[model samples]
Target: MAPVALIACFPCRHSKRRCDKSLPTCQLCIRKGVDCCYPKRRAQKYIVLPESNGVTKDTVPTGNDSSINRAGGSNRSSEWDQQSPLEVSYATPSVIQSFGTATAIQFIAPSIFREAFLEIPRINIAIPSEVAAHTGEFDQIRDISATFFSQVVIWTPVIFRKNFFNIALNPLSPRRTEGILLSLCMKLYCTPAAQDHRDGRTALYKATKQFYCEVEAAGIMSVCILQSAILIAIYEIGHAIYPAAYLTVGACARYGIALGLDKLLVDLTGENNAGRPWMEVEEMRRVWWGILILDRFLNLTNPLRGLTTKDPEYDDYLPVDDWTFLNATAKPQDNLKISAAFNLKMGVFTRLAQATYLVNQALKFVSSLPPPSDSDTVDIGKDTAQLRRTIWALISVTKTEFDAHDLATCCQTAISYCAILLLQDCHWRRVRISSTEDAYKHMFAESECVLQNLALLAICLRKDAEEGKSLGEEFPVFLMQIVYQGALTTIEMGQGSPNEEIQERVAQYKWLLQHLQSRWRVAGIYLSILQSKEAIMASIA
Candidate 1:
């Protein structure tokens, strides 16, 4: 009989080397001064008795099939398969208990969709032979990368500007993650709708995927890797490819969680190493918030789908002002100087994040309430009144903080208006058409306020783009959806009176949508509605 194979020491097994099976410490582990551990013998394989007839035979649980052990096989669906929101408990069990059983649902990038993410095959397209000039290609990528940092990075401010340039500036140094980020950025800049740049988009996408797989397989985790994923997610969102974005951001969130980014390390006692810059801590916080923003926005865009990050725990403050971020060189301490201007600018997104969380909570609460019959009108009114109070309170808080004439203010106001719209959206449409005096009166006032908010948003967008101060129609994809919502509201309101200013505003939206329609499908829908409404108005005149 063949001699039984010796089980290797843990160190040797981990290093994939031979072990002599010596006592105390193996020779190799002793030489390396590493601890030597031995694994327990595997349990004898046994058959699992079927609980019912016609069930397939199951094997004893093993390390490779731990998931199967939990589910009793690969076939059973968990809570995720039902498309339910993930209820993330607080990191501290004590805190969670004290916070009450509010049951917040964070849209985590569910593992149920892991198969779909893995299905994005590794692409390996080569660069064109004609463009094989190494120096030329390098310069071109750097230029596109600059465009990405300046234009695209604004939408997802998780990436640290200085660090990105370090890799981008030195093209000769082999950096796979940076290369993938550059390629994705190039693709976003040269989307298919750009007509002249369409060919480059596909090439960039293939190259990005190729490099991403290679880097991912190497098991690398760093800020650059996380930033690359965020950029790719943003690029996917710009093209309205949500599932792909969801997958990318989901992976990004996993990486962030693995890095413990949700909590500020600086806040933890003695965790900061001597040389670790305050910026590193800030970077983690920014990346965490960026992930949260995308997670909430993704769910907001498609309420039907399960969320990407569940009840995310964030104890960090909102990002500091741009002036402080861009200018400060010294290590920052507690009480970092904040810029009112920058706060005014970012307040919309900050409040939007909070509103989204509230919305999720509200959704959970609403779902739990017993369904009411038509005769049970009192219960429905109570629920509606409670929701309205919550929404108005949120609006009051947001409005009080930043009340400027900028896009941020306009966006927040629109969101507050949307809260009211959300409650009565279905009936509001009916109210607009109803002959009842009370219904018409209510619809007219709400519709007018909504249109004014949208008009301000449109003007802000138009003015910013026209003056070349904006991202050239590459505005936040979600914001574009809001603008489109405003357009629909404009159409509904304009059915009664098509005044010159309203007509002019509609024309401006039409002009803006023409530029955005390629990247955002909602813009295309808005353009169609605006054009159709114009045609109808013309026919009536």
Candidate 2:
């Protein structure tokens, strides 16, 4: 069985700060001068139930199935209304212990290398032949590739499909290795949790991860390898794989820098840009952007941590628009129509990137604010006003119900509103600490407006859900962060509310995540957070 770890404290839970949940007091609470209150709680045995029909097999609860446990076999779904998020299956500590902890190097490389490093004269390496690099059955791989492109690609798009199918599918060709690595990643991402980790890591995850380590050992490096790392990181994150998720993404940032991915778009405007293959460059650019996006999104739970990559500069070029993804004549930054204010025209991936940028900005802005006691005399209204306007500019311009069928766009929309929720939270907290009535009223009015937009968008999405599938059956699995943030936002700040409107939103966002658990167990982790929040609110009342 996956070993359980301690949960976050109350302040950490509310603010997304990292917590070790130590007894007496936590380090974060000590540093911040905040109350370190662990819930006065006890454990109870949870029964696992089978998922209903029409549910994706992967959604069945796995112990850290990837990012979080799934809804499958949980008699707990209905219990959520009466339960706390504390019950989310947690196995990340053991994952870190197994992977690269100080006490043991339990995964990939041999522990002997670590123990006898100075004693060994030299480390010998083996090179595998082309046949040894072989992945899986051709037809099965083909189907997996198609499924990935059809579903997950709309958000991540790590590889370009048109070029991939044309050049890289051959097991006989040199490009076949990259295709195989990418295929391996998609298979890991797509495989259901039904047969996944019950007491230990699943067979498929172990095999794919081993193959990835082998490729690295064989000196394989490319955009596809990075994409594979990203898939693993995403999987780890969804399953709350913790330090592994953190470390995997940090490696991506470093590897991206090592590969000079930061220069991909910058090189586009140079005189030497003429001969470069636009498709290959696009793929490279997307991979780099993927690293950047993941780097920021991963830090959402710990906003004060230094980002692996620097925040995006105002003119940092965005990706080639997703719709014109195959356009041969398209030049990088040609699609950018910059103005003081502008419409969201780039594409869904770009939209996701933009929203992530807002999240980063919110983190920075909030981090810069002084504690309420100190900031009481500071005139920071201008700074707050400018930041609020910047958030709304994106939210106001986006097509609220644009292409309801495009799950990527839906994810993008949800994230943009999440930024508002994040910002309003900062403001709301400030007002409460200062006991400023004017500030509270202002925040309430503005937050209400922004939340109404989010609610409407959720309604449009709910309409599209199939009759029997989960509410979020069609959403991309990577959207768990945004959905979780939205769910947390719907609860009214300060006094507890019986507001029907607030309850509707709270239920709606929860429904989106509850159903999405079918494909990605990450949803279950977020639901646990909601449960924890409910417990806190209940205690206060």
Candidate 3:
């Protein structure tokens, strides 16, 4: 067969979406339930006419082809055409040769290198140069970079501080686009730009998002691009930017897949990893884990939505301490270590990974349970019961260790409690709980556990609040979802019995939600849900 031809359906053309150009229908069109049609006029769009003059009557397809003028004889088409090749693999034969006989891949044939590493294809894009357009802007860039690292680093420690600064400080440095985009992100987030647009997105947000889209559209797959996109997704989530936030995570999922960051990581193994530095591999692992964390946290409450990032495998390595990882010298992996297990000595990120794992396991366990119906009893299954016990035990211990721990830990503990409550609540509904006083008491205890954990989150947040700090600023935005669930659960338990303790807990949940709204707009969404529930409860009371 001849090389496949690329064409965009009219719908994709109008909507400004990527056209996979699949026969019958493109994926985006299929998603939107729209007709996919390729107009014959576009055939003339790509037809190349030989040029003896200053301009050629030819056009090349790109993300934004309207900007391309055929009369200008723009040679950009050849550079950006879909078939253009990108040199994505870092370890080439020449680079490996420098490591001498010590490098495992040095002696291996080039064919083996081709087989081991997949090169991501390239599409050329015009990187937005707002931050880098001037020589004098480096000082502002450095100043803005300070705001993101301190607390946001705890949420996802994917971007190394020194690497970011080196690229950021030296605007003319290699990988200039990465530096530019990162600087743009820092500037926007430092003193968040006012939402001047009617759509509620700031000018800075639009610029950063535009830069992100252009890079993604042009098939630029790098950790820098992924980190920028992930940061944008976090911003969307915190401010309750829907559909965009949801779609951004999905986009990052695709980007991570393209980078081969999530699965069958060849660079991480001791056998074939070859001459790549250990920190490089660690960065790879951290990026993958970061995706997993974001995906889980985004859908922690609504398991039905499923996960965008890959599920953590049995042999996956958890990150070492953030402090050590950031500051320490390179250590050769030469071995795959650190399975997903708990240790008190581990960093906050590791605890987050472990806690997130519990949530994922709970979701999987719940899937095994039969759907709810008019049944007196439901089988918990042997394996699932074992899993539930493990989750409960972990939550209990975290609860015991919860003294003066940071908000992230409290977020972890709170979510873990939410996870078990989710598992148990599905099979053991309120009607079933009232089946016996003991049953009711058991259910009540579980709610109280989750409620107290949520309350502790509020209390922990208050310290920062007392110091005139932003509530939920350092924590993941999906903590808003977990807090909402806590408030909802407290109300339900209170309705079951008008207990003073439950009511006091209800007040604490409200206060937490109220304070959290200062930092995360998603809190306002959940707070409204709580109000509606309270109104219904009052009428029924």
Q: What are the lDDT figures for the candidates, one per model?
A: 0.48, 0.56, 0.57
Clashes of 1: 9
Off by over 4 Å in 3: 1-136, 187-200, 264-267, 270-273, 330-340, 376-385, 392-402, 408-411, 430-440, 444-447, 459-473, 537-541
Worst 10 residues of 1 by lDDT: 115-124
* Tens-place lDDT digits, model 3, residues 337-406: 3353553455656666676777888777665566567763555433456666666666655556556435
- Which scores better on lDDT, 2 or 3? 3
> Rank order by TM-score, top first?
3, 2, 1
Please give, for residues 228-336, the per-residue lDDT of candidate 2 as tens digits. 8988877776666668788989998887765557776455532222334666667677777788877877766666677888777566667777767744445554545
User: What's model 2's TM-score?
Assistant: 0.67
User: Model 2, which residues run further than 4 Å from truth?
Assistant: 1-135, 195-201, 269-275, 327-329, 332-344, 378-382, 400-409, 433-446, 457-466, 469-473, 492-494
- The most accurate candidate by TM-score is 3
Where is the poorest 10-residue window by lDDT in model 3?
64-73
Could you tell me the C-alpha RMSD of candidate 1 in Å?
14.5
Candidate 1 has a TM-score of 0.57
**True-structure lDDT of candidate 2:** 0.56
Task: Give the alpha carbon lDDT tens digit for every residue of 138-216 in model 1.
Answer: 4565666666555522443455566555544543223323443444544444454444543224555555655666555
Evaluation by lDDT, superior candidate among 1 and 2: 2
